[model samples]
Target: MVRFGVIGTNWITESFIAAGRKVKDFELTAVYSRKLEKAEEFASKHKAVHTFTDIEQMAKSKEIDAAYIASPNALHAEQAKILMQHGVHVLCEKPLASNVAEVKDLIETAKQHDVLLMEAMKSTFLPNFQEVKKHLGKIGTVRRYVAQLCQYSSRYDAYRQGTILNAFNPELSNGATMDIGIYCLYPLAALFGKPKEIKASGTLLESGVDGQATITLTYEEMEAVVYYSKITSSTLPSEIQGEDATIMIDHIGHFEDVKIQYHDSTEKIISGPQDNDHRMFYEIEEFVNLIQSGKRESSINTHELALTVAEIMEKARIQFGLIYPADRLQ
Candidate 1:
C-alpha cells in the first residue's frame, strides 16, 4: 500500500481521508498542521498513524511515500517545491500554483528530482466527465459552451462584519475564479484546447478581490462563456449547445450526471454513476496508482491542461487586476 500524508486539516482533507478509506491501495499514514494541538486532533479523528507540525520533517519521514497538499493557493508552489526536494511525490490541490512561473518551477523541480507531481483535479478523473466528453459530439458541431458555478460563501457574512477570512483575502489567493472558475476552465481546456483570444472581466470587492466574474474565450468555430461567483449561487444548469443537439451538465465541475437531447427531441442519451462519496474518490484512486507505479507524469490526464488553465487564469488576473503577491513571478 502507498502511504499518504496530508498537509492541511481543512474541509478537503476530511474528504481525502474518507475517500482514502475506500481505496485499498492507499493508507492514511500522516497528517500535518501548523499547530501541534490541531495536528494531534486531526490525527486522532482520522486514525492517522502520525502527525506533525513541521512539514519539512514530515516530508522527509519514512512513514509516507507521497504527500497530499491541501494548503492555501499561495502556499501550494512553495510547499510542493519542498516536498519534491525531499524526495516525496506530491498531489497538490487545484490551481496547482498561483501563476504560470510557479507551475513551471514545480514541474521542473519534479522532473529534476524524478518524483511525481500531479494537480488534484477531481472532476477530470470522474467517469461522468469522461462520459460527457465521449458523447459531446452527439451534441452536433459544438458551437458554444456555457458553464456557471456560484455559491455564496458562508464566510462572506463574517467578512462583511469586519472579520477577514481567507476566502475574501487576495493574500491567500482565494477568490471566486480560483476557487470555482478553475472548474470551468479545466473542462474547457480539456475539450476545446486553449482559446485563440480571451476576455475576462469581474466585479471586485473593496477588499481587492473578485466576488463574481464572467470570462469569454474565443476559438476557431466556438466560444465559451464561463461565469463564477462566491457572492451568490446559480440556478441555471450548465449546457453545451450545438447545431445538432445539446448536452446539459448537472454541475460544471462536479458533473455527476449528463443528459443529451437532440434538436428534434427524438434522440436522447443519459449516462453517469450514482455513487457520490463527495466526488473525490476518483482523484484518490489516480494518486495511488501513480505512486505505486513510479510514474513521473499522469497517464489518465496530462499536465498540458493544467498548464493551459494556469495560463488562462493568469491572463484573467492581469485583465481584472486581481493580483496576488504570488503573481510577482509573472
Candidate 2:
C-alpha cells in the first residue's frame, strides 16, 4: 500500500480521504493540523495511525510515503516543499502555487529531492475528461474554446455582512480566479498549449480580489475565453468549437457530461456515466502509480502545464490589479 498523510482538516480534505479509500493501495497513515485536538479528531475519524500538530514533524516522521496538501492557497508550496525535502511524495491541490515563481521552485524542489510531485487536479484525471481529449479530433480544426464556472460562495453571505472570510481574503491568496477560474484555465492549457496573447477583465471586490473575471486568450488561429465567478451562478456549459463540430462539457471543473454536436445537426455523447462523488479516485490512483513507477511528475498534469496556468493567472491578476500578499514574497 502507498501510505498517505494529509494536511488540512477541511471539507476538501475529507472528500479526498473518502475518495482515497476507494483506491486499493491507498492508506491514510497520518493527519496533520495546526492544533493537536483537531489533528487527533481528524485522525480518529479517518482511522489514521498518527496525528501531527507540526507539519515538519509529520514530514520527518517517515510514517508516510506521500502526502496530500489541501491547505490554504498560500501554504501549498511551502507545505509541499517541506514534504518533498524529506523524501515524501506530494499531491498538492491546485493552482499549485500563488505565482509562477513558486510553482517553478516547487517543481525544482521535488526534482532535488527525487520525489513525486503532482498537482491534484482531479478533473483532468477523470475518465470523462480523458474521453474528451480522445474525441477532440472529431471536432475538426478547433476555432474557439469557451469554458466557465460561477458558483455563489457559501462564505459570500458572511462577507456581505462585513465579515471577511478566508475565501475572499487576499492575504490567503483566495479569489475567484485562483479558486474557480483555474478550473477553466487548466483544462484549456492541457488541451492547447500556452496562448500567444491574453486579455483579462474582472470585478475586484472591496477586499482586493476578483469577484468575477473574463479572460480571452489569443492563439495563432483560434481564441479561447474563460469566465469564472464566486459571487454568482452560471448554468451555461463550456464549449470547444471547431470547423466540423463542437464539444460541450457539462461542468468544466468536474466534467460530468461531454457531448459533440456536428454541423449536420448530429449529436453524440462522448463520455460515459460517471460517479461524480468518487471522481477523485482517478487522481489518487494516478499518484500512487506514479510513485510506484518511480516517476517524478505526472504526464498529464505536467509541471510545464502547471507553470503555463500560473503564468496565465499572474497576467490576469495584473490585468485586474489584484495582488495577494504571497505575490510580494520571495
Candidate 3:
C-alpha cells in the first residue's frame, strides 16, 4: 500500500485524495496544514490517521510513503525538497515550481534521494490523451496546431475590486500562462518537443500579471498558435489541422471530446468527458506506479518535459514583462 500524507487542505488536495482512494492499495495516512485546527479538521473529514501543522514532521514520519503537495505556486519546490530529502515520494501539483532553476533542483534532489517525483498533470495521463497520440499519423503530416484554454475566473471579479488573491499575483508566480495556459504548452511539448521559435504577447492587468496571452511557436514542420486567458471565456475548441484531415480537441485543459474530420466526408469521434470525471485519478495512478517501480521520475511526465515547460513559460512571461522573484533567483 502507498500510504499518503497530504499537504494543503484545499479543493485540489481533496480531489487528489478522493480520486486516489478509488485505486487499490491507496491509503490516506496523514495531512499537513499551517494550522493545527485546519489539519485536524481535514483529518477528521478525510479519515486520515494523523494530522500535523508542521510539514517537516508529517513528511519525516513513517506513516506516509508519499506526500501529495497541493500548496501555492511558490511553495512547491521548498516543500517538495524537504520531503524528498527525507526519502518521501512526492506528487506535486502542476507548474512544479516557480522557475526553471527550481525544477532542475527538484529533479536532482529526487535522483539523489532515490525517491519518486511526478507532476500531477491529469489530462496527459487520461485515456483520451493517449488516444490522441496514437492516431496523430492519421491526420497526415501536421501543418498547423491551435490549442486554447480560456475561462472566466471566479476570483477575477474580486481582483478587479482590488482584492488580489494568489491566483492573480505575480510575486507568487501566478498568472494566465502559469495557471491556465500551461495546459496547452505541456501537451504540445509532450507531443512535439520544444519549438524552434517562440513569439509571445500578453494583456496585463493593473497588478502587472497577465490577464491573457497569445503565443506562437514555430517547429520544423508546423506552427502552433496558443491562447490562454483567465479574464474571458472561449467557445472555440483547439485544433490540429493537417492537409488531409483535422483533429479537434473540445477542451484543451481537461479534454473530453476529440474529433477527426477527413476531407473524404468521414468523421470519427473518440469520446471523453466534456467535464471533469475523476480527473486526478490518472495522475495518481501514474505516481503510485512510478513509486512501486523504484523510479525517480515518470516516462510520460518526463523531467525533460517539465524542464522544457519551465523554460518556455519563463521566456514567454519575461517577454510580457511579467517578472517574479523566482525569475531573479534563476
Candidate 4:
C-alpha cells in the first residue's frame, strides 16, 4: 500500500480523496493544514491516521510515502520541493507551478532527491486520451486543432457579489488561463508538442485576473486555437480537422466520449478502458504504480510536459497583462 499525505482541504481535495478510496492499494496516512481544526476535520473524514498544521514537520517525517498537493497554485512548487527533499513522492495538482522556472526547479529537486513528482493532469492519465493518441493519425495530415473548455464557475457568482474568492485572485496565482485554459492547452501540447509561437489575449477582470482567454498556437503545419472561460459555458465540442478526417472530443478535460469522422462520412466512437465512476482514480492508480516501481517521474505527466505547459501559460499571461506575485519569486 502507498501511504499518502494530503495538503489542503478543499472541494478538489475532497474529490481526490473520494477517488483515491476506489483504489485498493491507496491509503490516506495523514493530512496537513494551517489550521489544526481543519486538519482534524479532513483527517477524520478521510480516515487519515494523523494530522498536522505544519507542512514542513509532516514532510520531514517518514509517515508518508507520497503526498497529494491540492494547495493554492502559488504554493505547489515550494510544497513539492520540500516534500521531495525529505524523501516523499509528490503528486501536485494542475498547472504544476506558477511559471516555467518553478517547474524546472521542482523537476531538479525531484531528480536530485530521487523522488517521484507528477502533475495531477487527470486527462493525460485517462485511457481515452491514450487511445486518442494512437488514432490521431487516422485524421491524416493534421492542419488544424481546436480545444475549448469553458464553465461558469460556482465561485464566479460569489466574485461578482464582491466576494473575490481565490479562484479569481492574482495573489494566489489563480486565473482563467491557469485554472481552466490549462485543460485545453496541456492536452493539445501533449499530442503535438510545443507550438512555434503562441498569440494570446484575455479579458482581464477588475481584479486584474483573466475572466476569459483566447490563445492561438502556430505550429509548422497546423494552427490551433484554444478558447477558455470561467464566466460562461461552451456547448460546442472540440475537434481536430485534418485532410482525411476530423476527430471530435466531447470534453477535453474529462475526455468522456471521443468520436472520429472519416472522409467517407462514417463516424466511430471510442470510450475509456473501463467505466471509472471517479475520473481522478486514473491519476491515483498511476501514482501508486510509479511509487511501487520507484520511478522518479510519470511518463504521461513528464517534467518536459510541465515545463512546456508552464512556459505557454507564462507567455500567455504576459500577453494579457495578468501578472501574479509568484512570477516575482526566486
Candidate 5:
C-alpha cells in the first residue's frame, strides 16, 4: 500500500480521508495544516498519527510516500514543486497552476527530479466518464458540445457585501475558470484535443474577479461552449450533441451517472456508487499506483491538456479584461 499525506485542513481534506478509507491500495498517513491544532484535529479524525504545521517538513519526511495538495490555487505550483523536489509524489488539486507558464515550470521540475506529479482532476478518472468515451461513437459524429458548471458560491453573499473570501478573491488566483470552468475544459480536451481557435468572454465582479464566463472553442467541424458561474446556478446538465445522439452528464464536473439519448431511445450509464464520502477516491488510487509502480506519467496524460485549458483561460481573461495579478505571468 502507498502512504499519503494530505495538505490543508479544509473540508475537502475530510473527503480525501474518507475516500482513502474506501480504496484498498492507499492509506492516509499524515495531515498538515498551518496550525498545530488544526493538524491535530484532522489527524484525530482520520486516525493519522503524523501531523505537521510545516508543509516542508512533511514533504521531506519518510512517513509519507506522497502528498495530496488540497491547498489554495495560487499555492499549488510552489507546494507541488517542493514535494516533487523532496522525492515525494504529488497529486495536486486541479487547474494545476494559476497559468500555463507555471504549469510548464512544474512539469519541467517533475521531469528534472524524476518524480511523479499529477493534477487531481477527479472527474476524468471515474468509470462514468470512461463510459462516456465508450459511447462517444454511439453519439454519432460530434457537432457541438456544451458544458455548464454554474453553482452559486456558498460565500457569494459575503462577497457581494465586499467581504472578499478566497473563492471570490483574484489575489488567490480564484475565479470561474479555475474554480468551475476547468471541469468543462477537462472533459472537452479529453474528448476533443485542442481546438483550432478560441473566443471567450466573462462578467467581471466588482472585486475584479470573474463571477461568470463563457468559453467558445472553434474546431474544424464542431464547436464547443463552456459556461461556468459562481454568481448563479444552472439546471442544464452538460451534454454532447452529434448528428444522431446526445450524451448527458448529470453533474457538471464530478463522476456519477449519465443518460444518453439517441433519437427516441435513452440509455442509463451509472459509474460510481451513490456514496457521499468523497469523490477523491478514484484519483487517489491512481496516484498511489503511479507512485508505487514508478510510472510517473498519469494514465490520463492531462498535463498537456491542463496547459491547453490554461491558454484558453488566459485568452478568456484578456477578452473580458478580467486580469488577475497572476495572469500577469502570461
Candidate 6:
C-alpha cells in the first residue's frame, strides 16, 4: 500500500481521506495539525496510525510515503517544501502556492529531492473533464470560453457581522480569485496554453481582498472570460463556444455534467452523473499511481500548468490590489 499522511483537519481533508480510501493501494497512515489534541482527534476519527503536532516530525519519521496538503493557501509551499526536503511526496491542493515564485520554489525543491509533486486539482482528473477534452474536436474551432463559479461563502455571513475569517483574510492568501477563480482558471489553462493578454476587474472587500472578479484573457484567435465570487452565487453554467458546436459544463468545479450543442440544433450529452461526494478519488488515484510508477510530476496537473495558473492569479491580484503577506515577502 502507498501509505499517506494528511495535513489540515478541515472538511476537505476528511473528504480527501474518504475518497482516497477507494483507491486500491491508498492508506491514511498519519494526520498532522498544529495542536496535539486536534491531530489526535483527527487521527482517531480517520483511523490514522500516527498523529503529529509538528509537520517536520511527520516528514522525518519515514511513516508516510506521501502527504496530501490541504492546509491554508499561505502554508502550502512552506509545508510542502518541508516534506519534500525529507524525501516525502506531496499532493498539494489547488493554487499550488500563494504566488508564482512559491510554485517555482516547490517545483525546484521536488526536483532536488527527486520526489513526486503534483497539484491536487480534482476537476481535471475527473472522467467528465476527460470526456470534454476528448470531444473538443466535435465543437470545431474554439472561439470563446466563459466560465463562472460564484458561490456565496459560508463564512461571508460571519464576515458581514464584523468577523474576519480565513476565507477573506489576505494574510492567509484567501480571496475570491485564489479560492474560487482557480476552478475556472485551471481548466482554461489546461485546455489552452498561456493567453496573449489579460484584463482583470474585481470588487475588493474591506479586508483588501477580492469578493468577486471578472477576468478576460485574450488569445491569438479566441477570447476567454471567467467570473468568480465569494460574496454571491451564480446559476449560470460555464460554456465553451466553437464554430460548429458548444460544450456546456453544468458545474465547473465538479465537472459533474457536460453537454454539446451543435449549430444544427442537435444536442448530445457527453458526460453522465458522477459520484459528487467522492469526486476527489480520481486525483488521489492519480497521485498514488504516479508515486508507485516513480514519476516526479503528473501529466494532468503539471508543474507548468500550476505555474501558469499561479502567474495568472498573481496578475489578477495585482490588478485588484489584493496583496497577500507572502506577496510582500517576495
- All candidates' TM-scores? 0.97, 0.99, 0.97, 0.97, 0.94, 0.99
Give Cα distance to truth, residue 306, candidate 4, Å: 0.8
Candidate 5 lowest-lDDT run of ten: 268-277
**Per-residue lDDT for 1-330 in model 2, tens only?**
999999999999999999999998999999999999999999999899899988899999989999999999999989999999999999999879999889999999999999999998889898999999999988889999999999999899999999999999998898999999999999999999999999999999999889999999999879999999999998999999999999999999888889999888889998897769888899999999988888888899999999999999999988989988898886
| Candidate 4: residue 168 Cα off by (Å) | 0.7
Residue pairs in clash, model 1: none
| Per-residue C-alpha lDDT of model 5 across residues 74-150, encoded as one tens digit per residue | 88988899888888888888878888888999989989999888888888877788888888888788999999988
Candidate 6 — worst ten consecutive residues by lDDT sum?
268-277
Reference-based lDDT, residue 235, model 3: 84
* lDDT (Cα, 0-100) at 47 in candidate 3: 94
Error of 5 at 47 (Å): 2.1
Q: Give the lDDT of residue 87 in candidate 6.
A: 98
Candidate 6 residue lDDT tens string, 3-72: 9999999999989988998999999999999999999999998899899989999999999999999999
Q: Which scores higher on TM-score, 1 or 2?
A: 2
| Cα lDDT tens digits for candidate 1, 1-330 | 888899999998999888878887888889899999999999999889899898899988888889999999989999999989999999999979888889989999999999998898888888888888888877778999999998889999997899879988898888988999999889888898999999999988888789999999999999899999998988778988888888888888778667887767874556556447767788778878877877888865567778999999989877988898877656
Residue runs of model 2 more than 4 Å from their true location after superposition: none
**In model 6, how many backbone clashes occur?**
0
Question: Lowest summed-lDDT stretch of 10 residues in model 3?
Answer: 270-279
With candidate 2 superimposed using the best TM-score fit, by how many Å does residue 221's alpha carbon deviate from the native? Answer: 1.3
State the RMSD for candidate 6.
0.8
* lDDT at 317, model 1: 70
Greater TM-score among 3 and 6 belongs to: 6
What TM-score would candidate 6 get against the native? 0.99
